[model samples]
Target: MFKRVLIANRGEIAVRIIRACRNLGISPVAVYSEVDAKALHVRLADEAVLLGPPAPGESYLDIERLIDAAKQTGCEAVHPGYGFLAERAAFARAVIEAGLTWVGPPPEVIDLLGDKVRSRIAMEKAGVPVTPGFSTEEPDMETFEREAVKIGFPLLIKAAAGGGGKGMRVVNELKGVREAVEGAMREAQGAFGDSRVFIEKWVQKPRHVEFQIFADTHGNIVHLFERECSIQRRHQKVVEETPSVAVTPELRKQMGDAAVATARASGYVNAGTVEFLLDKDGQFYFLEVNTRIQVEHPVTEEVVGVDLVAEQFRIAAGEKLSWTQEELSQRGHAIEARIYAEDPAGGFLPAAGPLLYLEEPRGPGIRVDSGVVQGVDVPIHYDPIMAKVIAYGPDRETATARMIKALEHYVALGVPTTASFLRDVLASKPFRDGETQTDFIELHFKEWKGETDQDRQIALVAAAILPNGVKTLAQNGGEQQSWRQPTPWETLGSWRIGGNS
Candidate 1:
């Protein structure tokens, strides 16, 4: 085991990695930008190094600075926790060349799988089912137009080198193919530094399911079941659950087999997610591989009783997988709701302000993986995700009920969040019936105004309690005297409001 490991990321994932390192008796080092000097992850690590300014290019994305920090901290390994440089192949190579263990798959595998076109070809050769589409190393306007006709209308023009909805366009007809391709390529180049694009047939009303697969240098590999990530907005997952209503026992076995095959075909090691789109007809097609620990991995952990981050450490230390395919089984249903610092009503616009008041739901089944605290400033320089709340139960109904209650109790004032929105989603009839699809939000919540009667009641409670002192003023008509109340600052008087405080 490594004496120390450096977390080359920030926010909740960094804090998560630190905890795992501590559990393994390894000293954890944290790297942060200037704005994150007082962040929770920084406070949790045994040691921390300042990278640079708030800009990601100068800070978290700087491979050289990250490598230097790891070496200077005497860390034997570097763990890129999910975002920033997690999927960047060059960063992994840099760490390996620096004589430090990289807690992920080989750089060559990352590079190969990063290219959507190349990965599709590889999966096809490995006998995994792939979506019908046209892919080429060199594509032009004429070729794209021709391919669009063959692939039919309502196809996706996607970036070859990136996901997360970046550089992606859905075209309904051939007239929009050229413009969409040009737009997708430009956005792809800007986001991923690669202009390559590909075309794929769009499966209507598909459920997004992904399998958790892990491997080791000892040549042992297994899939840890699947996560249902169909509830999404703008191609990003909002709520994720395990034991999908769409996946039966036989279907889970099929998808799990394909997921493991994907890992074996790519020579993939460590933890990764193989995503698939399950059509209404009970068929599944490969989507892409996320070459890192996922944001919703806790759902799988909660059900499978595994610490995935710790397993990553063991794999990097040249240990075999602790469990085999036969030994791994999901004991219960788990659902995870991502809490972001964004306004769901205001078109999900990212919000930043002081976390004046905060409270996390706690119970037998609730788990909150949070990074922000009360009285801290929510910065706008990075992803607006503040935390993730996961709930588990013996069955889906119980899990759903727990999740709804947990969301109802979660409180964060001074900045808008998706808690209420997620609660509404979970309580809706369609969600309860498990009719979720990739376009679930658009189909059901296209007009979500966000402020319900409950919100108004909470506002009234705040107004009543926040008036520390009042003065009366007489009107000309001598009506009951009007009252002027003190401000929030005067009422609170530097007292922090939170579960911890």
Candidate 2:
């Protein structure tokens, strides 16, 4: 067990890691940029160090600075929570060279699996089915063109070292291959510093499913079942659920076994996810491997009743896995909705402003993981995700209903959010029938505006009441002094007793 651990990230994930460390009796050390000096994660950690300016290149993404901070803070281990330096193999190696435990997979494994082309090859060698694709160190346009024709139309041009939908493009016809390939190469170079790109046949109506797998240094590995992440926009998942309604008991076993095999082949350790694209015919193909804890891990934790973070710590400490495959089983369905500070009406552009008023829902089977607090400024310098709302229930219907209710009650003022859009998607007929696919958002929501009469009414009421010195609903509980002086109603404007005006 580590006496102290440095969390080299920010936002809700940092806060989440801080709580996990505390619960395990480990003091958490947090690092934050100048803009995040007053962030929730910094406030909650036992100790915090200033990184640099607001820019990620100078702050959170600085590997050398992160290592120095951990060593100087007397941290025995470093936990890179998801983004920033989480999947950077070089960072993990740096942490190890500094004599601090890295709470993730081995650096060599990260390097191998980080590259999409190499990972696909590894999965194939491990007997896991992968989509037909072309990969070459020296990318020749002619070679790519030939491969595209063999793979047929509607091929995907993807970065060899990409995630989050960046550096990716879809070519529907032969005429678009050259333009798509060149564009993908440029984007991939800018985003990942790797100019390598590959082409794969795009399976139509594919459901994005992922299996969470854990491995210990002792060579023990097990898969924690699957998460249905097909509810996406721009190739990024917005909503994720566990025990996918699409994956049956038999299909679960097959995918779980394949996931475990893939992890073993890559010499993986700690936590990682094996993502697959499941077609309508129930055939699944390996998509990619995420070498760090996923953002949607909570849904798996809710159903499996396992504290994944704790397990990560245990694995990094060289302890054997606590639970065996036989001991673990899914209990119920869980759904997670990412609440980002973005406007769905404005083409889902990121919105940044002070969270004038913020309220998160709470109740049985509902969990809210957040980093922002009321009055906190959401800067434009980072990801716009403000929080995650997760709900668990005995079945999918109940979980879906709970998520809708939770999204409805969630409130944030001074900045628009995707809460309403998430609610609409959950209530839509396709989602209700479990007809989720990779193109769910594009197929159903193209040109779909989110404007609603309820939103207008709420805005009108808020505008009409706020100027009258009436505090917003979220601000009513605390002791507040009215900024405005006595109004006409409070002074001499009120009717006498029951007399009419």
**TM-score, every prediction:** 0.92, 0.93
Off by over 4 Å in 1: 454-458, 467-501
Cα deviation of 433, candidate 2, in Å: 0.9
Task: Report the C-alpha lDDT of model 1 over 371-490, residue by residue, as the tens digit.
Answer: 987655678999888999999999999999999999999999777999999999999999999999999999999899987686788788878866433212222213221123423422
**Which of the numbered candidates is closest to the native, going by highest TM-score?**
2
- Global fold similarity of model 2 (TM-score): 0.93
lDDT per residue for candidate 2 within 1-501, as digits (tens), equals 888999999999999999889889998988888777667887787777788899999999999889988987788999998888888899999999999999999999999999998888888988999998888889998998888999998999999988988889999988899999899899988767888999999998999999999999998999999999999887889999998989989999999999999998999899999999999888999999999999999999999999999889989998999999999999989999999999887788889876767889998899998988775678789888899999999999999999999999998877899998999999999998998998888888876688757679888997897756855433543323222343433233112223332
Q: How far is candidate 1 from the true structure (C-alpha RMSD, Å)?
A: 7.0
Error of 2 at 52 (Å): 0.2
